[model samples]
Target: MSGLRPASAGRGESGRYEAFDHLATMVAVLRAADGCCLFVNAAFEAALGLPRRALLRRGRLFDWFVDASALVTNYQAVVANQYSTVRLEALLRRPTAPHAEPLPVHVIVTQVDHGETILLELVEIEQQARQDRETRTLDQVRVTKELIRNLAHEIKNPLGGIRGAAQLLEMDLADATLTEYTQVIIHEADRLQALVDRLLAPHRRPHMVADVNIHEVLERVRSLVLAEFSRGLTIVRDYDASLPEFRGDREQLIQAVLNITHNAALALAERRQAGDARIVLRTRAARQVTIGRQRYRLALELHIEDNGPGVPPEIRDRIFFPLVSGREGGSGLGLTLAQDFIQQHQGLIECESEPGRTLFKIQIPLP
Candidate 1:
């Protein structure tokens, strides 16, 4: 509770509670005697699917729970100095549109100000699981990147030596027919060298900085992808006109987007033959987005959605890993490069796929 103190009130009590609004976790403050709601943070309010005024009008925070008996008994115990903190699982009722089911949550209630004020935090069980999963994924990706970078460096020098030796052998060969074998060795070595370069490209390239218009980047990707798949692929632009320009490497963004869009086009091969392949490039401004561990007040959301057979269930999770591909003959570095580029801007990329639709979502913070 050291830095958790409410801000000093200048205009009103609600103004003092503004400090809690920045937190990604749901928080509520209530009077301990009767469990009357005093303040609800942005996350809490959003979870309850109600405005602050409406929530306060309802009064008791306990009423929002499906079974208030557990909370009520715990609240009384905490207020009576029986305990300083209590943690339990509960089902919270949301009466707003789009929330059709009771939300399962982990609730933490702590006595503050000598048990006069109660601090309550509610973490959605699903949200907590998602955060945990994302944390694990990020950690795994970091370890994988480090290993790949080190392995690529180890292979790089030997690769050049192998190609040079093969070239020298070919030049000194007595029989022209035998030179074919050396040529094969040189060609294969060059191919492996190229593969190693792709693996190391993101680490080697400096992050160039400039103001980037996301729409322009998408349009560039759209045109490039359409050029390759000229006949049946349709790239639809659904741009948010009010989105602000952000500082980033314009070329990197373009290439990242191009990679994703090109993959979507390739996935639509069967649909392309039918002349109905479609991809949507949608952009919007996202609020209160938690990317990685940091929460951003505003961020850009770019979704590249395609109407193709979704990513294979077997390889879906590893799509961003180097050399893991759902498509045949895929080099599998596209999504990996895209992820690395977006991460260089302190952003993240996620994919959601089903039978008929696959969406690649990218999030970058805005000023």
Candidate 2:
């Protein structure tokens, strides 16, 4: 309350001052009753690329926002009703920046009465990073799943027919050389059948939603990785033990996590140095995350970080697409399937890779 002061008046005239600061991704501020800037934090300045003096002269906070009218209306309501806190999101525009994009911000406004004027605090939503990732992952999964279903159905019938014809040809063949050709046809058909089976596996199965302890799944993946690469690679765990159980298909989640972790292990396997091949599993809890444009109360964040050489830069953007692989012999379906499973649980999977570091982050909402 004491921090509220008119912009025309100096800071010393504001009397005994109290500052409220919250750590958030973007800029934030506490404003006076007249909508003058009282306290503007460093994040706000950095995000807008503006100095505190410029912000102070800007007068009402709404003036800088892209849709200032709506914000002003909400603020006025708070003032009239003595509302203690209100949350909203809006597009913000810089005064003279033409090349900058309109930034989406989640704002939290609070009314405080320290003395003669009302005070309001603003918090920008940086948590949107996770939300954006969740949205893109969901979209990718949906499209990939549909493609797999269609492709599998199209190839499966023809593959069976070809295999049956090859077997019949083998039975009718008199020459041994002719039978060898039939065997080759049968072998290739079998390989195609196997690929189709993998493509349809997720849909053919049913999902069993149960309260699952994520740590247990991570532990199982860890054990499996160690057993496969016991000699050289290392699997590290950075778990938050207090994480609550979330409703999910246990086996599906396990497989989804395994696919990602296994791919990392394989990437590490090709590295020359033994100790340099390291995979770290980290987990945390996040709040107010949006997936598929729908907001959720809480979500679990899982990160699989590796120290091996990162994904190739060329195909990085399309890695989640069907049949995209960085490895020579890889089937490229592992991540696609993993993404599908996670999307079924209303979650997402995202990756960021650079030389010597690659991070795959999975976020699933918790009930």
Candidate 3:
């Protein structure tokens, strides 16, 4: 074992490394010679499903991985000054429960101060994949929103001209039958105008921000859906009363939730006739959650689940894309608008669907 080194003050103080605990990635400082752990952050402890004291007492960090050969070789190389940094993929063992599997991680190692120890960072493989997916999703959403807005503006300009021309033609028409044709043109043009307005609604409306009680929003959505699907539809509420209110746009949240619940009710049409339709609105508070690219200490998790046919596999990945629908006569803007509004509040919406069980989960950061 390497001899213990005394703290030299300033940056060498043990407290200095405490800031690493706030990071989402697992981190550890190790003695390169024998792989003894000198420091392990909160994320490292949580990822290993062990207490910080326990991990520190265990003495060596090499045993944490399923296979330590690769790590051992790299640690030695860094210790011998063969390389300044190294990265490899490994499976980290979890000893928390029976039959638990090891977690796949991308390991990064770099020499620390004095060259006696090295800093090790473990990035969860799933987290890296999620980060990539979020980046792509955000990029796509930005491009789609811009394209839709520009297209809507182009349509809106022509729409007014069409309606005005139709009105003028109706007034000058000598034959009553020809007036009917003009009226048809005017009516169709008005319908198209309304459609365009709906498409531009998110961009046009101002965000009315206020202190919002999420439960209140759910309650409002619950009542609206219940009233619409009064017969054979059971709306169950499973709420965590301890959840605190946060700043948000209350009306936008209400509409976002209402859209999902309404879609759930519509999907349960077959079960509604059999008198066994069910929709669940469940809420709880989650801690240390990563939403999109940022991590939050606390967030509100709201789940809208239904007992109905699952989303079609072909369109499941595109549900949040504008004008993508799985149901007949669906305008396909409900989920898209819901996503837009949730994103405005710096939150995320995810859906998991399977036969007889479809769940839409919304996570919003809380103060």
Clashing pairs in 1: none
lDDT of 2 by residue, 208-271 (tens): 9899999999999999988988867878889999899988899999999999999998888766
- Per-residue CA lDDT of candidate 1, range 1-367, in tens? 5234546746565776788889878899888777888889888777777888888898888888889899889888888889888999999888684457898999998987666788898988988887886777677789889999999999999988999999988889889999889989988988999999999998888888999899889888887888899998888989999999999999999999899999999999999999999999999998777888989999999999999999999998888888888888999899988998998888888899998899999999999
Query: Local error of candidate 1 at 42, Å?
Result: 1.4
- Per-model TM values vs. the true structure: 0.93, 0.70, 0.90
All-Cα superposition RMSD per candidate: 2.0, 10.0, 3.4
Which model, 1 or 2, shows the larger TM-score?
A: 1
How many pairs in model 3 have backbone atoms within 3 A of each other, for residues 3 or more apart or on separate chains, i.e. clashes?
0
lDDT, residue 222, model 2: 94
RMSD of 3: 3.4
Off by over 4 Å in 2: 1-33, 36-137, 270-272
Question: Which one wins on TM-score?
Answer: 1
**Which is better, 2 or 3, measured by lDDT?**
3
Model 3 lDDT tens row, 1-367: 1233444546553465776777888989887677788889888887877888898888888888889899889988988989888999999888785378889999988887768788899999997887787777777787888998999899999989999998988888888788888888889989889888988999889999999999899989989998889999999999999999899999999999999999999999999999999999999997667887788988999999999999999998889898899999998999989999999999988888999999999989999
Question: Over the full model, what C-alpha lDDT does candidate 1 score relative to the true structure?
Answer: 0.88
Runs in model 3 with CA error above 4 Å? 1-14
